[model samples]
Target: MRSLLSRRFRATRAVTAATAVLALASVTGQVAHADTPAVPEFDDGFGLSQVTEDREVHSSTDFSITVTTPEVAGQHKIRIFLPSDYASEPGKRWPVTYFLHGGPGNPDEAGTVEALRSDQMITVAPDGGRKGWYADWLMQDTAEGAANWETFHLEQVVPLIDANLRTIPDRGQRAVVGLSMGGFGSMHYAQTRPDLFGHVASMSGGIDFGNYAVRGAVVATELNLTTAWCAVSSSRGCADYGPVVDSDAIFGSPYPVFNADHIWRSVNPAASANLAKLADTGITLYTGDNDLVENHTADGVDIVTSRLDKLGIPSRAVNYGDGSSLSPTCNGGHNYGCWAPAFADYIPRLEAAFAAEETK
Candidate 1:
């Protein structure tokens, strides 16, 4: 259901050469990718049923894999940056890190990939698709290139990696981190499936999708922008994993009348069953002092930390304030300037978590 806002948004966007390339790209948007399948296909639940693309990079193995899966409108993609000695050390099994990118992910996320690849673990980046919301659609689009992102990542992608790669393949052996939309995805996925990830971090993620300072600000505005793209700058350009859809397609209608179920609330970190699982997991929250979304991004971090106060589950809360040596954001808007440092701040923590699991 492309609305007037969508049409207007598409018409007014600044699609740069790199961004035009992004529109039909992978989850990271760093490499060239395959077109989404016309009809959806299911995986066997064991591993990748079919692989359409695979290529290599330098000392570390950087490859993008396109696989057939019923969860998405087209083939889901996986971008892997393997350890430098991944080829030489066949016998050694390594821990894995899952990186979730933002709505339109940082264009040059190569640093993060390189860091993970060289850091002593394998890096796994899965395609979240355009405006996928990192959640399965509440109502199916039933159109070409529709997406079932939740099933695609948790059901299809996770097993696909473990089955094929030499991963420790356990809860403590794996970590998940994301930027912005991915921040939401990382936390949501970590909470929803407590068995899968040992460590979770969100970089400038508007995590309080349910109610931060004001209710529904995340899904209604930020998440909504990803769907219709009403306010994206040409510099940012769209990053494509699949077709862009409206917020309704992912959660529910943007307007309040349609969200009586509080789908957003259900997914919030403060909700049910959270008392136990999250207490066992290491959680990190990051947000720049000045975010483009009126700094509400910080509100979610505050809310989650405050709510979890009794449990003492959250390990770290890093707010790169207006005057900090680490990711100093002197009141500037949301940009990559902060993410790189935030990512750097989290890498060691991820390594520490992975190391802890190795001992047990």
Candidate 2:
């Protein structure tokens, strides 16, 4: 968590990828949290076998699970937050909210969900990988063959929760929310598998990757320096973290001059086909005027918000002007301060979606 926050604050200023990686590379060893000891250690989620290292986090309320599946290499870590009354009411099933974190991001980013104090909704957060971008990579070597995030989350994680936990197991009982890159994943997952997630919300997520180079560059840079790549790198007995690859490994190229651009367009939530599938899924998009690199986000969230309006997709739009005031709580840009408030506002809305169906 220390490295994640350090990288975030510095990255907010448009720093180079090398600088960002170097800044946190040293601290990456301090990856696991004391309260949550089960979290993956150095080179976590980037493809390192930390399965035996798994342990429960936050006692009975919030626990972590290591899932093994063919969707991606390495052991997957998921944090599950059960309702306080879960043990008291053994037969009572509950609604679920899937929380996705950002690049170099963890499932419990900034303790966003914990701060919400919960809403009688089960919170299931899966490691979307550090910059996994929640997609199966276009190339194997691109992500060092450790992609397949979408399949892992939807096919493996989702079912594992439903079967093991007392969840409603219906689309109306499920919602997905994420910040930054996970934001893109939530919206795309909902759009692609409308039957899986009934409601979806994105916080400062990059919805249109094709329109902005920064979006692609960010992904490329993060992918290049993955933990899996670093574990094998010729390090001087230190966490090298990466050998420094290129965007080509992930998408072939950052721009649309080549065929790889099509992959970007395809995964984009704002794309015509993607948007077309959202008619049945409740959609919400959020971004702050004071957010870091707000312009690049506009090409994503803002444009998608506009397109949603134009397409008449039932959606909620929160500008959270400058991320000020708690009246209608809106935090600052891409940071957790912004996300905590945004999440505080969105969680109830998500529960309401589930409640609506429950009453029916």
Candidate 3:
């Protein structure tokens, strides 16, 4: 039930930092809400389902937790990589950084455990499933049930990390970061649950799923909603037929189906009513210039940053690119070339945040 370093995926060499990048242009938009919505309560019980050790050259204590979802009856896996010094430091409580993987994750994915082990904070990576997107799925079949990733992570996983591991266990000590689909998940979580995370970053992620074009392309994936997120290929198609996707999934299908105004009111971070709630939270968003397939990613960063600016929320949005215009160290792409360095650079910021909290 547990994996070792022998099961680790070969680490890809991290690319250099981005030297050249784009900046999001100024934009004007009305924020939907001034205060965040209330956090729903859930039954909380977390324990280590299992644990394993890997003595590979770069190995630490590994954890496997089985979480039960709200509607689903099956157990999901959550893998964790403790700090390299965890075993030696018996009484220390390290901070935690949650790392979310992209959609339709590779079956053999071992996460960035090896690359991030050197950091002092524990790295938590959960199996969000091929299409979970970290959102509570609407139970389509009462018999089988849906994957309630949101509840499992917030209610169970976070508590388990604190109870079982040497963790600071404070909201100010927690951080979350992700790439692509995981990026969207990170922002959504931070926006929805500001009490749980102090810092959040999204690299090459889609934050504006309310946009029909963005929604259509994302849901077009076999893992997402398939044909449900779209009726025709055009944004206008959503106007005539309401939303093409099921209302039960992701956000509940409100009455006004076709209008994005209702569908993403509670979900889309960039367009949600609680967008201002992230003002106090540390926000870092970036995307690669050469991410052709997900070109809208950078645009999503722009949308959130713009809204944050209007609400007086400070954030940094970097547009990384290949060394063409400036002395670029990081290459622009959707793969490891961009994500690796972004993650590497972010860890220090997380540490600093925790340090600042300790002083206060």
TM-score of each: 0.75, 0.77, 0.72
* Highest lDDT against the true fold, candidate: 2
Local error of candidate 3 at residue 234 (angstroms)? 28
Better of 1 and 2 by TM-score: 2
Lowest summed lDDT window (length 10), candidate 1 = 33-42
Report the lDDT tens digits of candidate 1 across residue range 1-360: 346686564434323322343344444444432232111112334434455333332223666656667667665566777776776676999888888877554322544434555448888887775456688778675443546788888887887778667889898988888876778888889988889987898876757755534334334433444433322211254433334344455565544455654676677665644534687888898876654452666777777788777666656887776525674533434555666666776787788778877897
Candidate lDDT values, in order: 0.63, 0.66, 0.61
Clashes of 1: 3
Output the lDDT of residue 353, model 1.
73
Query: Of the candidates shown, which would achieve the greatest TM-score relative to the real structure?
Result: 2
Ordering by lDDT:
2, 1, 3
TM-score of 3: 0.72
Worst 10 residues of 2 by lDDT: 229-238
Task: List model 2 lDDT by residue over 276-300, tens digit each.
Answer: 7888888887777663344456557
lDDT of 1: 0.63
* Runs in model 1 lying further than 4 Å from the true structure: 1-47, 51-60, 106-113, 142-145, 212-247, 253-259, 272-276, 328-332
